[model samples]
Target: MSETSKMLWAVLGAFAIGFIVVGLSKQEESPEQKEAASMIRNYVTIQSMANQKCPEAILKQTGEEVYFPSETVSDKETYITLKWVGEKGFKKASCTVYGTLGGISELIIDDKVIIKKKI
Candidate 1:
């Protein structure tokens, strides 16, 4: 092959590899994203309970924090730990929430609950 043709093929190969990488990246979510989703769900659920005026005993646990989205506006990569207290039938259910604890609206779960911590 001519020198120019060889260079063209090399460039094409590089482009193909880059394309594959980008496509794969979009299809596969990072661990951070999964964690963020989990955190958002827990926070929203627990915040819901908090709004219901549940007993402090039900709200206090290993990972409990009063999350204020307004305070985290400056930092986009903030991580927060949230505690959700609740009861399911006879068993007690508590959730520990953590994620890219940045904004009140950034984290969304199933298009149902907005991450805005309900007062």
Candidate 2:
């Protein structure tokens, strides 16, 4: 046909190929990647809670300074701990994630328990 039609077809073909590749790559996500992603999401939720409810405990620093020392995943639950030191000695938040993101079962900040859900 015309040059313009040929160019359009070529672009469409490239777009289809790119979409297929992306879909395949996503399907190939390993168990480790999935677990990491879940942990990250759980961490973000915990941080957001800290920012909203206990802003004073959260110290101001580069994001790199935030540390997660513990991460344990069992068949029934996943536990993640986020710890950082602020002006007031040590600060920490521990999150227990359950049932494929059903909701955080518990979130403890420092010595205080912020969220404690039954089962």
Task: Output the number of the lDDT-best candidate.
Answer: 2
lDDT of 1 by residue, 48-83 (tens): 543332223233331233232222211212233232
Per-residue lDDT over 2-119 for candidate 2, one digit per residue giving the tens place of the 0 to 100 score: 9999999999999999999998877677899999888777666654543343333233222223333344433322433344443343455455544444555666656677667786
Clash pairs, model 2 backbone: none
Cα-based lDDT for every prediction = 0.42, 0.53
TM-scores, each model vs. reference: 0.28, 0.36
TM-score of 1: 0.28
RMSD of each: 14.5, 8.4
lDDT at position 14, candidate 2? 100
lDDT minimum window of 10 residues, candidate 1: 68-77
Instruction: Give the residue spans of candidate 1 off by over 4 A.
Output: 28-35, 38-119
